[model samples]
Target: MSRSHIALVGKIAAIACIIFIVFCICFYKTIRTGFIEAQFDRASMYMQGEGNPQDFKKAREYLEQSATAGSDNAQYMLGVMYEKGQGASQDFSKAMNFYKQAANKNHAKAQYALGSMYDHARGVPEDHTEAVRWYEKSANQNNPAAQYALGYAYYNGIGTTKNIDKGLQYLQKSAENGYVKALFYIGSLYFEGKNIPQDTKKAFSYFEKAAYKGNHDAQFYLGVMYENGNGVKRDYTKAIYWYEKSSKTHSSAAFNLAKMYKNGLGVEIDYNHAFELLKRAANGNNIQAQYYLANFYDKGDNVPQDSAKAAFWYDKAAKQGDSRSAYRLGEMYIDGRGVNENFDKAFQLFQQAAQDGNVQAQLKMATIYFKGMNTPIDHNKAIEWYQKAANQNNSEALLALGNIFDQGLDVPKDQAKAVGFYQKAAEGGNVEAQLKIASFYLAGTNLPKNPAKAIEWYQKAVDQGNIQAMLALGQIYEQGIGTTEDYQKAFEIYSKGLSSHNADLQYAVGMLYAKGLGVSKDIEKARNFLKKAAQQGLVVAQREYAKLDLSNQVQDPNMQTVISYLQEAIKNGDAESMFILGNLYLNGNHVTKDTKLAKELFMQSCEKGFENACHILKTTY
Candidate 1:
């Protein structure tokens, strides 16, 4: 070829070669695009069950291949497959990975999915900030789920500073987008007054919407609103209807309904229904329901009483520091009712109860210390507990303290202190204290001799059925100490006192009968009364019984008694009996005389503060 023609041919050949290269590149691009499209189409077909045997496994495989080829939609689908285990094993880690890829590409659904994963800490450690970032991105794109999530984060301050106004703004925006979760969240916020002014009407409206959509929590809350008359008229039937609806899915609603049934508050008493509901709640790990169920078993009010079952529940509650359960365990240990009787175990449980401020336990500890029952007597500790109970206005503690001072049992003898305590107990309307105050006045021991005051206090005690007070009133009337001498009134009072089963009262009655003060002279009645009193450690009755002459051979029962009254008196704390018995020993009235036995008896009576026996022991002996 000519030089110019050869150059033109080389240029044309170069242009042709360049055109072929461009066509080949376009052809290779088309084939690669077709391959990726085919992979994604296959996944879509399997997902929709449009071709082949609607296999999620095949769909996952195709979706995985497409996702590996950088298809954002395919990646999102793959993530959903992994999340739901649709043809693949449920793998949160892999699901999150695929979702992150699509989320990075600004895929709305993927962004929401990844945000939920972070919100719930499903896959990785919960990073709320990351979740909020993705949610906001998708929410800005008008994704309804993302909008609801962003609102939740704002309302709860999950990943950002809490802003009630902003939270409600975002939630309202999501609700406007037809997001049901946003509506539910708005209801919660309104109900709790967190991100909105408390508006029960608005809350109930939103809750009704979510509840209608089968949200168990919303249904439960709506039931509560109706039951409590919040933003609605209280309707037990409607409340029960909604609670029944929620109970199918929510355990708390079942528990609340059970309580209502058990108490007959909003429903008829139905122990059987309550028990069934409680069992459901307990299975759901409702702690309060567990405690109540245990109590039912323990008391057998509605079920068979089972101590073992009670211990099971008590053990569960005790681990949670329930004081009532601890107290029950203590009682069990103390009495060996359902467990082994162990004082140490009881003490430990009682200590736990005391720490919880149980007043009865404090009193129990005081009694244990005071009586030294199964433990050593600790007076100081007893005083400490008594003081504790006294501060709580314990009636027994007040009376005990008064007695301690009056008789000097544990503390030093102080009539002033004794009067102070007795005054306290008397002010509390203690009958015994009223009578004791009356006695102090009658005897002129602590207060000045004031018969009027004595009679007034005695009348108060008499109103409380104090037999001693009646006897004292009778004496006052007989002696004209506080009132005019009325023999008939005194006789009536003494007759009433004598009818009591109390040993002291019976002895007082015997004296009145013997003296013919209350009723007509009846020697037979006097002996019978004296015999009853003698069995109760009354020294005077024993002395009177010893004086009765049983040697007479008479037809009457009084003169034909077999036992000597003197022998009965000698068994009691009678100084005269001691002298008589001593003399009997000295003179050998019924046996040989023993000088040592006589001396010993005189010394014993003398040491017992008997003046006559003391004189005999020092002089006659």
Candidate 2:
């Protein structure tokens, strides 16, 4: 070959080599593109049921391979796969790792996922403060979820000072991005009047947007607003429709729907469906749902009564510090309704309830101490416990304390203090205290005599079933103490009093008859009522019965009855009975005039704290 031809051939060969290298580079780029596209295609096919019947397992494998190759979209998809355990072992840590990787590449969904992981402590220690940092980073990048999360943190004071204004600003920005959750949260803020001038119209607008996006909580809130006419005009049909929509997945919404059905508020009453819905809510650990379900089981309200089931739910709520549950548990233990009778357990449970500020429990503990039932009597402890309850404005406690002071049970008798406590309880609407307050005035013990006030209080008590108040009214009308005497009204009142079980009431009736206060003087009726009162050991009645005329009165068989009645009354610490018995013996009218027995009875009455008996013993016997 010629020398010129050889040089041209070498140059051509070098050019050919450069062309081959360029061709190889283009071929490699095509293969790489195809490989990535193929993985994406496979993932999409599996995800969409186009291949392998929508197998998450196959989709995850394709997504994992592409994600490992540094594809931001694939990394985001892989994070979701791991999060949902799609064709893989559920791994929040792996999901978070993929999310963080994609987030570093400014993948919007991945940024939101990483922020949520930090906020919820899923696959990492929960750090709302750190979550805010990451969320702000993504929010600056126009990530809707990050913006919404940042808004939530600000509104709720989560790792930040609550700033509803700033929260609404960020939330509105996210809403502009079509973030449904942001709209829902902002709507809730407006509806609840949280740190914003409440705007129910704007709230309803936001909620409607989120509800259209199929956000369950937003739907539930929309239903609530419609039901309550808070953000919308009252519309039961709209409330029921939205509630049914939300109840499909939300147990709380289901519970609300059940309540509506139970009360016929927005739907036809359907107890069967209501029961099913409530059970779902109860299973979700809704405390109010559990309480209502337990009550249904306890009462057999359209369901089988089951005390055990009632106790089961009550215990569940009690462990969560529900005061009413604790009280019910105490009752169950005390009564052995759904558990073994255990007074000690009941007492402890009652203490727990009382510490939680349950007035019923406090009063119960006081009554136990005061009555010494199943425990030793502790009057001081009783008073202390009652005072604790009374400070909470418990009328029963105040009345019990008033009575204790008035009767000097364990404290010095103080009518003034008694009246003060009674007034407190009376103002608290205690009918018993009202009657006692009136009695203080009528007897002129604590306050100045005020007949009008006495009658007023007595009338209030009578309206509350106070028998004594009724009898007192009868006497007032009969004697014209506070009003004009009315004999006909007095007879009617005395008749009512006589129908009661109080022997003193019967004696009053007998006095009305004996004095001809209402009816024509009827000796037969008078004697009959006196006999009834005497049988109840009334000392005056016994003396009157003994004074009845009879031929051979000394030898009359009724003398023996009088002596027996007087002896029984003396044994009951009646001072007048002792005096009358002593007089009988001194006159030799009964029992052969036994002076020693009379002296013994007199001394016994005197020692029983009766001053009249002491006087009789000193002067008569």
Give the best candidate by lDDT: 2
Q: Write the per-residue lDDT of candidate 1 for residues 454-505, one digit (tens) a residue.
A: 8889888877777878878977887788678876677676666555666666
Residue pairs in candidate 1 whose N, alpha carbon or C atoms collide under 3 angstroms: 545-565, 546-565, 546-566
TM-scores, in order shown?
0.58, 0.72
lDDT of 2 by residue, 1-621 (tens): 999999999999999999999999999988876777789789989999984688888888888788776678888888888888888988999999899899899887788788888889889999888888788888988988889999889878897788877877889999999999898888887887888888998999999999999999999988888999986898988998998998868877888988998888877899999999898888877787788888898888999999989988887777777777878888888889878899998898888887888888888888888999699988888888888889998889999999899889888988778888899999898988898788777777687878788888887876666678878877888889867898777777667655566666677777677678777776567667877988987777765555442223223356667677767766666776777776666567645878887787668768877787688778874
Q: What is each predicted model's overall lDDT from 0 to 1?
A: 0.79, 0.82
Number of residue pairs clashing in candidate 2, backbone atoms closer than 3 angstroms, sequence gap of 3 or more or interchain: 0
What is the RMSD, in Å, between candidate 2 and the native fold over all Cα? Answer: 7.7
